[model samples]
Target: MSRENSLVSAQWVEEHLDDQNVVLIEVDEDTSSYDKGHIRGAIKLDWTTDLQDQVRRDFLNKEQFEALLSSHGVGNDHTVVLYGGNNNWFAAYAYWYFKLYGHQDVKLLDGGRKKWELDSRELTDEVPDRAATTYVAQEQDRSIRAFRDEVVAAIGSHNLVDVRSPDEYAGRLLAPAHLPQEQSQRAGHVPTSVNVPWSKNANDDGTFKSDEELQKLYAEVGFDESKDTIALCRIGERSSLTWFVLQELLGKKNVKNYDGSWTEYGSLVGVPIALGDEPGQADGKSA
Candidate 1:
C-alpha cells in the first residue's frame, strides 16, 4: 500500500471532518486519554478492552470484531482514520487490526494526537452520536501475523527486528522504562534480532520520518529489505509502527508483526533466547 493511501495528515482529517464516509478513531495505551479530550467527531477504542478477547490472551474473533465495529458505527465501506498518543503506538496496532480483518480503506493520522496538540489544533470532550451499521468483517488474514513457531524458525534467516528499548533488548528490563517491569519469565531478545527502538521512527513532534530516512534507519540495522521480516516488542503494539513503516511506507511486501512478541517467546519453555545487545550469536547465547 502506498503512503498516500495508508497515511493521512491532520489537515486532511480536518478537511474531511464533515464527510459522512470518514470515521475518526482514537486508540491509546492509556485508555483514559480519549475521555479527557480527543479530536472532534473521533470515537475511542480502548486497546485493553475493546480490541482484545476478554478471557483469552488473543484478539477478538471475527464475529466479535464485527460486533465491536458495528456497535461503534463503523460501516464496511467507511474510511477509518486512527490516531492516538505516543506517536500513534496503539493507533498503529488498531490500524493493523483493520487490515487483518480486510478493511478496504484505513489510514493513520500522521503524528497522531501529539502533532495535533503541538499545532494547537482543536480538541473536545464532546463525543459524536453516530448511527450504528451492520459492519461485516472478513475472516482473519494470517499473512501479516507471525506466531511464536514462525519466530523460532526465522532465527538467523528472516529479518527479525526487535523494536524495543536498549534496556529491554539487553535483558536489563522486562518492559519499557515507564511501564511496570513484568510479563516474561526471561529477558533479552530473540536470537539474531537487531534492536531498533520504535521511537526512532518518529520525529520530536510525533510525525514519522521521511521515507528516505526510514529506509536508511533499517539499512543501518542490517535489515534485508527483500527478505521476509517479523517485527516484535514486549507485546506487539510498538512493532506495529515499524511494520507500517516497512510495509506501508516503504512498500515492502513480506513484513509481519509478531503480536505474541516477548511476552510469549520469552516465557516459552526451552526456546533459545539471546542476551545482551548487538543481536548476540546465532546460537542464541549472550553476546
Candidate 2:
C-alpha cells in the first residue's frame, strides 16, 4: 500500500498487521488509554513525553527524534501507522511532526480508536517486545511548520486560520477546562486569523467529511487553494488535524501548521493580538 495518502481504513490496517515493514503506534493525549487496551503489536507513544522537548516548549531535535524512532524499533523504510483517542487529535499531530522531520512513510488510522473499537477489531493489553533499530533522521523541513516569528511575519501576507473554539478565539476563555496545558497568559487569536473549529472537518463517526462537504465548509470561510495558509490552535495539535485536512486531503499546495500556535503567540510580549473580530472579518462577530 502506498503511504502517499495520509489516511487508511481500519480494515486496511488490520490486513497489514503482519507486514514485516509496518509499524503501528498509538499516540494519545491521555497516555493511560494504552494500559486498558490497544491494537496488538502497537507501541504506545505519549504525546506529552515522547514527542515534545523536555527542556523547551518545542518539538524534539533530530538526535532526540532518532532516539525515539530507534527505541520504538521504527526504521526508515517502515510504514508508520498512528491512531489514538480524542478523534485522532494527537494522532494527526504525530503525523505532522513525522512529516516535519522528513519521515517519508506516515499515515493516520482513519476514525482512530473509536472506529477500531466500533468495528470490534482486535485489541490487546500485551506490549510487544522488539529489538531497537538504528533509524536515520532527515533534515528538518520548515515549510510545513510555522514558528512564532514566521507567523508574525505572515500575519498580513498569508491566510491565517485559528482552528479553536469561538470562545477561545474571542478572548472569552484561555483554554478548555479539560486542556489545562493550553492555558496561556492571555486569550484571543492572532490578528487577522479566521475562526474555523477543527471539528467541522470530521463526521459524527470520527471519520472525515466528504470532499464536497469539506470544500463547502472551508469555502464558507474564504479558504481556497490559491493562497498559502497557516492553521493554529491553543497548543498546535488540533491545528495539525486542520493542516492535514487542507494540505493533504483537500490537496492544497502550501498549507502550514503553526505548532507554537496561540500558546506561544498569546503569551509572547510585544506582539499584536486581536480579540473577537478583525476588520472585514470572515464572519462578523461581537464579543
Tell how far residue 207 is off in model 2, in angstroms: 1.0
Q: Give the whole-model CA lDDT for all candidates, comma-separated.
A: 0.93, 0.84
Best by lDDT: 1
Off by over 4 Å in 2: 1-4, 180-184, 277-287
Candidate 1 per-residue C-alpha lDDT over 105-207 given as tens digits, one digit per residue, 9 for 90 to 100: 9999999999999999999999999999999999988999999999999998999999998999999999888888766379988999999999889999999
TM-score, candidate 2, is: 0.92
**Per-residue lDDT value at 172 in model 1:** 94
Runs in model 1 deviating more than 4 A are none
Worst lDDT run of 10 residues, candidate 2, spans 278-287
lDDT of 1 at 186: 95
